[model samples]
Target: MENKYQFETERLGFRQWKEEDKIPFAKMNANTKVMKYFPNILSREQSDEFDS
Candidate 1:
């Protein structure tokens, strides 16, 4: 994969989103704690749809 920009911190690397990040991104969106400010937790289907 190629990114136009890349940067490294003491313990982390930052880059643009990749296709492989979809699952983890979906999991984050589906997490109840992460969605506490919203109306409700997202279903897997909803998360998948949103990630698209």
Candidate 2:
């Protein structure tokens, strides 16, 4: 597959969301520790809707 990136630094990279990333990103959003700054954990459905 071809690489898709929005931008990159010497040691970091960034990109916009792709269809394949929704599920994994939702999983990350569902992690309480990862969402610690937020008031509550998000359900997978809610997380899935985050970018919608």
Give the clash count for each candidate: 0, 0
| Model 2 spans with C-alpha error above 4 angstroms | 1-3
**19-49 in candidate 2: lDDT tens per residue?**
8998888888889889999998888788778
TM-score of each: 0.52, 0.65
**Candidate 1 structure lDDT:** 0.76
lDDT of 2 at 13: 85
Candidate 1 regions exceeding 4 Å error are: 1-5, 37-52
lDDT of 2 at 45: 85
What lDDT does the true structure give each of the candidates? 0.76, 0.84
Cα lDDT for residue 15, candidate 2: 84
lDDT of 2 at 42: 82
- Please give the lDDT score at residue 49 for candidate 2: 81
Give the best candidate by TM-score: 2
